[model samples]
Target: MIKTATRSTIFLFLLFGFLGFSQNKKNFSSIPNILQQIIPNDRIDSWVLVYNSYGKNQEIRTSGGKKDYTPQFSGFNLFPTEDSFYYIAYAAGGKMNYITDLEGLRKFVGKIDNAEEAAIVLTAEGYMVDEEFKDVAGNYYEDTANYYLDLGKLTSKECPYQKTHYALTVSKSSGDVSKVKDNGTYIELYNKKCANNPRLLKIQKKEEPKDDPKKSTRRK
Candidate 1:
């Protein structure tokens, strides 16, 4: 009788385990459908792994406070004949980054083996992970919620730092977390949090240069 009871318990545990796994799959089914459509093919085999990683990990994590992972992913179809969406992928092996620019170029952020967590490290140092972006094709994807701290943890005077349009087209040079007088790094401002953040509002108050540095000083 004891043997039978043990066998039944083992069976029930496995049954519930399988059900829980299936439920998790059901929750993330949409991610694959959306990502697969615009995934690039330059590194076909590696990108396959990234897709699998997305399926397994479909959520973001917060640590400490607002200083965790916040690398923005931005891109669109470079051309109608090709499909290329740029973003950072967190995988069991590590993170795979597809850095995209406004010129419609897509390339790996660094070497596959040595590139582990490069995006997170760079962003933490003030360098924007994304290159430049124009999401005309709606391929500009954002994996992070852009909220470093949860609502319950926020103080009364503090407000969540919301990314404008999910920071889709924002880009900055390596090691540039602060503002420069004439650095051409493109930035998307917060549409919602400026009212609550006086410092951010002051940054927004900077007038756009009439000369258009991107057109005059920068190259295409």
Candidate 2:
């Protein structure tokens, strides 16, 4: 366990796509017009919002219009940790639509004590409502603008105050995560999009081995 317990922490809004995690903006009720401008396409089809705070999980699921979800996650304990919190989401074959402002979430999490990071887990398919974790043990994480976990590189955008770290991730198929890397910009691997189906992005390996050629003696 990564130990995501932070004090004086508050989870504003958490969005879950079949693939990515997002921050909820419902709290910006005072600035309705402004909020819309910030997140023009905040709402999407077959999307859900998972907001956690004060030891509870709140979700809002919808096909497109009406919202349906649980007010709180029962039996799950979400204690505030050192600038951190915990959350869960569903992955429909690793394909989903996510709407959020990564920079905003990072800023919000950074404000809380010990709240410099976050994580997301896409449980095994066919058991969306089941509380038990069915798939692998490790979970995806997003500290600010980066996403990582057991798997390699996921995303690397930009976090609050320019902080970066591993967070949550979900894989539709069973596999192992090796290493994570960033090209000094975007998270190339996780940001990939395909038509008609979803695909897992991976880091390209070097064609040549790391062994020093000069050290090798000529074959006699």
Judging by lDDT against the true structure, name the best candidate: 1
RMSD of each: 23.9, 21.0
Cα lDDT tens digits for candidate 2, 60-179: 233333434333332221221233233322223334523233343333223222111222111111011111221221233344434443221223232211212222332223222234
TM-score of 1: 0.20
Q: Write down the lDDT of every candidate, Cα atoms only.
A: 0.31, 0.28
- In the range 1-220, model 1's lDDT, one tens digit per residue, is 9999999999999999767643432111122233333333243333321211222422222112222233444433222113333333332234433433422222333221111122222232232222223221112221122111000111122354322212212223232223222223233344464475566666677754466777876765
The estimated TM-scores of all candidates read 0.20, 0.20
On the 0 to 100 scale, the lDDT of residue 178 in model 1 is 32
Shift of residue 21 alpha carbon in model 1, Å? 2.7
> Where does candidate 2 stray beyond 4 Å?
1-45, 55-63, 74-175, 179-220
> How many clashing pairs in candidate 2?
21
